[model samples]
Target: MLLKIGLVVIGVVILYVVVQVLLYKRDMKKTKEDLLTFVTKNKKDVSVTIIENDDVVLEWNADQKTPLASTVKLVVLFHFVKAVSSGAIKLEEKVALSDIERFYIDRTDGGAHAYWLEVNDFSEHATLLDVAKGMMQFSSNACTDYLIDRLGLEKINDQMKQAGLTEHDELMPLTPMILWSAYVSDRRRDAFKKMSGVSEEQYKSLMNEIFNIMKNDPEHKKALEEKMKKKNLLGWRIQSLLTQKLTKSTTNQYAHFMKLPG
Candidate 1:
């Protein structure tokens, strides 16, 4: 009788394990199906990665290299946090408003340029955390531009390279009209003057610096190659243009545009 009772207990435990395993697999299948359906319905090229209990359980790339619209803000926030943590930028450090940030605010709020704008009165004060929050929540152009300037484009690009996302691209800040025109037309020469707001001589010098860096960096070269291999022809082309410091249309002409390079 004792032996029979022990066997019954063991069989019941085995059944419970089997039931749990079956339920887990069913849930996973349902999740994948739901994700695929949503992507298809929206006609969006997106990549979904799921982690469960510290393990990656699902990876679906509708279009992995496609430029993420506002999602790139996440990368900007990531870098901001890193910079603060590393003591490269102090959280309490005050960054005075530049012409760029002021311009953005004026245009956004329909304020006049000649009007006096103070830090507390100028619509907003830009702190380290405020910048990060702006990037993450609103994907604010002014906030992103400010952060990029403070952090250095090269530093951000390097962090992206280290993160293993190499296909992301960035352009220098430009005027709204010029930026919009470039986005619409994808013309480099016409927008060059408008975007950089510098003399031709200065622009030429800046281009040379960017070219030297791209020409010398092995990781950048490899990332471009990998992007090409993935059949992201537009992305490959955009990287080439950026390396040459040639202004293109909108930055998102290619598919995914992550703030970090993959």
Candidate 2:
């Protein structure tokens, strides 16, 4: 009777273990199905990955690349915090708004400039911390550019590399002023194309020559005007473009490298 009872007990233990394994597999399958369904219904041309406890639970097209958009600001913020923690910059440090900085703000749309215009003091002094806050909170382009100048773009990029951020490769060279200038210039070019009868190639060539001269020659302003006159592109709109110059990870690899450690 004792031997029979022991054998029965062993059989019951095996049955319990088998049931647990089955349940675990079932749950995992359900979770994957739900995730796929969610992505299909909610996301449009987006790559997604879900990680838990250092493991990728679900992933789809995770290797695909897409525009970082405002998400890139997180990189800037990450570097800024590191700077503060390392005693490279102080929170109370005051930065007087330079003429160039002010110019960028005045000319660029929807960035630090807009925020500054709303709340800058009579003396135009703002702390380093405040500028960082403005960059994150207000998405201020002016503040971002200023901080980039202060921190040195190369150093920030180096830090990103050392941290092994694959996403940073596409997002490097974060120059807000240049970006704004290009944006405004592109719009102006589009407008020119629509409003003028000149051939697109001819117009582009003329603009390139004038910009090249402006960069290399001290008399670029005059030269620009002359070129524009020759091409019949000279106008307030073209001039404004110069002023505006002021104008992702794969499943397992992504999970390992993409997340920021606390």
Task: List TM-scores for all candidates, in order.
Answer: 0.46, 0.52
C-alpha lDDT (0 to 100) for residue 246 of candidate 1? 33
In candidate 2, list every pair of residues with a backbone clash: 111-140, 112-140, 112-141, 181-245, 244-247
Give the best candidate by lDDT. Answer: 2
Looking at model 2, report the run of 10 residues with the lowest lDDT sum: 242-251
lDDT of 1 by residue, 8-119 (tens): 3334335434544553566765676897688888654446655555555766662344444444544555566567657788666665555235324223322322122331
Q: Per-residue alpha-carbon lDDT of model 2 for 19-67, expressed as tens digits?
A: 4455357665567789778778867556767888877787767666544
> Candidate 1: where is the Cα deviation over 4 Å?
1-38, 42-44, 98-124, 167-262
Q: Candidate 2 regions off by >4 Å? A: 1-44, 99-112, 116-122, 170-258
